[model samples]
Target: MERLNGYKHLILGNHDRGHSLAWWLNVGFDEVSEHPIIYKNFFFLSHEPMYMNKHMPYVNVHGHIHGQKYAGVNYFNVCVEHWDYTPLTFEQIRDAVVPSEEQA
Candidate 1:
């Protein structure tokens, strides 16, 4: 929580059980809606990747799964073990998702 001080926080509905406690501690929660966040690029944040497909014009960012996988559509799992946050740029995540041409 100290790390995120001063920065705005938002929570998804599918968040795990302990989120309520965080909310009570004065965190933020914005009901996942069709409207997407368009900073740099359209970005969507959710607990599950499945829900991301329901909307469009946005790149989905999720963190329910411990592992990461990319299908070249629109999904990025930024969940890291032990670390409460992941500091990765979109380009970094894109590189991780897209396979190298040599591999293809």
Candidate 2:
């Protein structure tokens, strides 16, 4: 993973348990979370898609939705099955959310 030159953050999945936030941080993650976290005030990161609506201020990037690609208008599914098994960068995520909100 060190081959990649960028920041890395961890959001716990449902199966992740018995570990403290400090444990993850000590393991080398820039940031560690056990629940949804907002990124750059534009992205909602989570293990499972949630809080998706047409009225939110940020888009959701989640995993449990799997190959669905998107769970709703503001959701971007980043499950391994959907992304060819790679992490989505900030640029990739911004590029995915486009059109600046169209009629919906």
Q: Which candidate leads the pack in TM-score?
A: 2
What's model 2's TM-score?
Answer: 0.78
lDDT per residue for candidate 1 within 2-78, as digits (tens), equals 55434443434344454554553464432323333444455666655654453565667766677555443677777
* Whole-model lDDT per candidate: 0.54, 0.77
Backbone clash numbers for all candidates listed:
0, 0
Per-residue accuracy of model 2 over 5-100 as CA lDDT, tens digit each: 577788998776678888877777788788789888899888887877687888888888754665466888888887787777877877767664
Pairs that collide, model 1: none
Could you tell me every candidate's TM-score relative to the true structure? 0.49, 0.78
Model 2 Cα displacement at 8 (Å)? 1.7
Scanning candidate 1 in windows of ten residues, the lowest lDDT window is 27-36
